[model samples]
Target: MATSNGGLRNMTEGSPARHIVLFALPLLAGSFLQQLYNMVDSWVVGQYVGDAALAAVGIGFPVIFMFTSLFMGLANGGTVVIAQFYGAGELDRVRDAVDTIYTAFTFSAVPVTLLAVGLVKPILFLLRVDDAAYDDAWLYLTVVCAGLIGTIGYNLNAGILGGLGNSSTTLRFLAVAALLNIALDLILVLVCGWGVFGVAIATVVSQAFSWLYGLWYINRRYPQIAIRPFCRRFDRSLFGQIMGIGLPAGIQMSLVALGAMVVMSKINTFGKEFTAGYNVGYRLDQLAFLPVQSLSNAVTAFVGQNIGARRLDRARQGIRVTVVSSVVWSLLMAALLIPFGPNLVGLFSDTPAVIDAGAVYLRCIMPFYAIFAVMFSLNNAMRGAGESMFPMLDAIFSLILLRVPAVYFLANRFGSDYMYYGIGIGWMLGFTLSALYYLSGRWKRHGSLADRDRRA
Candidate 1:
C-alpha cells in the first residue's frame, strides 16, 4: 500500500512515461474536484440567487487569485524541495522542509487574512466592479478572505504529499471535500436560501475539512516528523532554500494574476455582458486545460525526483513524454470544445448575448491550448531542476509584458473577439523561451539546494 501510494517509490528506476501517467491520473482527479469547489458554488448561486450575485462572485475572483499566489509559490517550492530530498533518500531533510512550509503558512495566514478582509472593498472599487454588484461582492469576498487559512492549509499539505508522489491521498481528500461542498451548496442555497453567503460558507467549510483530514493523514503516515510547534527551530538556510525557489514562483504567479486583473479591468469597461462572458469562458477554459496543468504537476515531481537521484537523462526523458502527452490531450480537448462550445457556455447563462460572447472567447482560445500545454510542461520541468528564477522571469515576460499589452492593443482594434488572443501569443513566446533554455542543458548543474547543502 505504501509503495502504491508513491511515498516510497524510486521513480528514477521506472519507465518514465508510465510513472508520469500514473502519477498524473490522481492529480487530474484532484484538479477536477478542486474546480468543483467553485463550480458548485457558482451553479447554485446562478440558479437560486441571480445574475447579480453570480457577477459579484465572478468579480471577486481576481482578488482571491492574487492573494493566493504567494502561498502557492511557497507550496510549489516546498514540493520540489521535498521531492528532491525524497529522491535522494534524504528523508530527514524532507521532514524538515515540510515543517518549514507549515511554519511559513501558519505565520502568514492571519496577517494575510486580515489584510484581505480589510482591503476587499477598496480593491473591488479599484477594479471598477459595478455598483449593482458591490454589496454581494463585498459579502462573498470578505467571507472567502476570512477563511484563507483553510485554503492555504490544504494547498500546503497536498503539495507536500504530491512531492512525495502521493497524489492519490490528496485526491481522496479533495473528493471528500467536493462531495461535502455539493451537499452544502444544495442545502444552503436551495433549501435554506442562504444565497451567495451560503456558497462562501460551503466552500470554506469544505476546504477546512480537507485540511483537517490531510493533517491527520500526515501525522499518522509520518509519525517520525513532528507537525506541531511548526517553527520550533527554524533552520535559516533550509528556509532560505524554500523561499529562494518559492518567492520567484510567487512573484511569477502574482504577476500573471495582476496581468489578468488589468485585462479584467479593461473588460469591465464594456459592462456586465462582456464581463460575464469573459469570466464564464475563463472558468471553462480552466476546466478545458486542466489535464495539461495536472500533467505539469506530474512533470515537476518526475523531474525533481530524477534530478535528486542524479538522473538528468531520466528527467529530460520525462519532459519529452509529458510534452507529447499534454499536446495530444489538448488537441482532443480542442476538438470536444469546438463542437459544443456554446452549449457548454449556455450552462452558465441563458441570455443569448452572454452565451454568444462566451462561445466566441472559447472558439478563439481553444485552438491555441496546445501552446499553453508546452509552456507549462517546460516551466514545471525547469522549476523541478531548481532553475526557478529564470522561469519566473520568463512567465512574467510572457503573461505580463507581452500578453497584457497585446490584449489592450487587440481589444481596441478588433474588439472583444481578440481579448483572448494575447494569451495565445503569450503561450507561444513562453514556450519558445522555456524550450530553448531546457535544450541548452544549463539546468543540469542546478539540481537542488538540499543536495548542495548536504555536499557542503
Candidate 2:
C-alpha cells in the first residue's frame, strides 16, 4: 500500500481511482479559488469602473497568457521530471529538478517581463482593441507584466508540490491569497477608486504574497526538496531534459494564445459590448471547466509517478478513471450553466446586450465541453509519460490549423455567433486526433525516466 511521509504520498501502490480522486480534489479547489479571484477582478472593475474597463481587463488576458505560456510550459515539464524522480525514490534528483526549475524561471522572467511591458501597447494595437478600452487595457497589462515574477513563482511552487503528490498545501496558499485579493480589490477599486489599474495591482500583490509564503512553507516543511530561490542551481543535463519535453509544449501554448488573440481581434470588431460579454462568458466557462482541468492535472501526475515506478497498468487505469470523471463533470456543469448563464453574466454588467451576448456564448459552447474534457485528459496523460511532442503537434493542428481559420471564415461568412460554433468544431477535431493517438499505444514507448534507467 502507498504510504504518506511528511507531505508526500506514494501513488505507486494504491487504487488508481481513489488516489487520483484524492489528489484532484485539492487541485480542483485551488483552481476554483484562483479563478474566483480573477472573476472578482472582473466583477469589481465591471460593476464599479464601467463596461469599457471590463472589456479592457478582459482583452488583456490573452496577451498576458501569450507572454507567460512558455515559462508555465517549462514549469509543467519540471513537474513531470520531479514526479518521476519522487516516484522512483530518488530524493536527490527531485531536489535537483526543483532547483533547476527555479533557476530557469528566475533568469527567464526578467527578460520576459521587460519585453511584455515594452510591447503591451503594440500588442493591444495589433489586436485592434476598442478605442474606449485601449488605455485601460494598456494600463492593466503593463502593471501585471511588471510583476510577472510573482505569477511565475507562485505557479511553479504549486507545480513542484503537486509533483510530490501534495496538492492540499497549494490549496491553503490559494485560499489565503484569494481572500487577500478580494479585500484588495474592494478597497482599491471601490473605496480608493483606482479602477482597472487597482484590480491589476491587487492581482500582482496577492500573487507575490502566495509566492513568498509558498517559498517559506516549502523550505520549512520539505527540506528534502527545498527550493533556494537565489542559489542559482542549474543542471545542464537536467535543463536539457526539461526543455526537450517543455519547449514543444511551450510552443503549442504560444500558438494557442496567438490563435486566441486572432479570434479576439475578430470579436473586437463587433464592438466593446460584445467583447465585454465574451470576456465574462469566457471567465464563467473557465470556472465550469475547472473540474476537468484539475482532473487532467491529476492524471498527469498520477501517470508520471506510475510510469516512473514502471507500473504501466496502474497508469492506464488512472487515465481511464480520469477521462470518465472529466466527461461526467463537464456534462453536469454544462447542464447547470446553460439554464442560468444569462443571469450569471448579468451580475457583472447591467447592459441587456452584454447579458444576451454572454449567454449566447455560453449556450453555443457549453454543450460541447465533454469533447474538450476528453481531449485534455488524453493529452495530459501523454505528457505525464514524457510524450509531449505529439500532443504539441496535436494542439497545433487543432488550434492553429483548425480553430483559428474556422473562426475567421465563420465570422466573416455567417456572423459572430458562428465564432462560437468554430470553437466547438475545433474541440471536436482535437478530440478526434487525441483519441486516435491514445489508441495507437505509441505514447507508451516514450522515454520516461524509468525507461531511461532500465536502458542504462
Q: Compose the digit string of candidate 2's lDDT tens values, residues 327-393.
A: 9999999999999999999999999989988998999898889999999999999999999998898
- Please report how far candidate 1 places residue 103 from its true position, in Å: 1.8
Candidate 1 lDDT, tens digit per residue, 1-456?
225432544577779988888888898999998887777676677667876787788887878888888998988988888888878888888888877887777777899889989988788877887776778889999998998888888888877887788788888889988999999989988999989898889888988898888888778876754465355656678888888888899889888888888887787777777777777787888887888988899889889988888888899899999999999999998998877888987898887777887788888888888878888889898898888888898998888999899888889989988777877888888988888887888877786555698777
Q: Which regions in candidate 1 have their CA more than 4 angstroms from the true location?
A: 1-8, 229-231
Structure candidate 1, residue pairs in collision: none
- Candidate lDDT scores, in order, read 0.82, 0.89
Off by over 4 Å in 2: 1-3, 451-456
Residues forming the 10-long window of minimal summed lDDT in candidate 2: 447-456
Candidate achieving the largest lDDT: 2
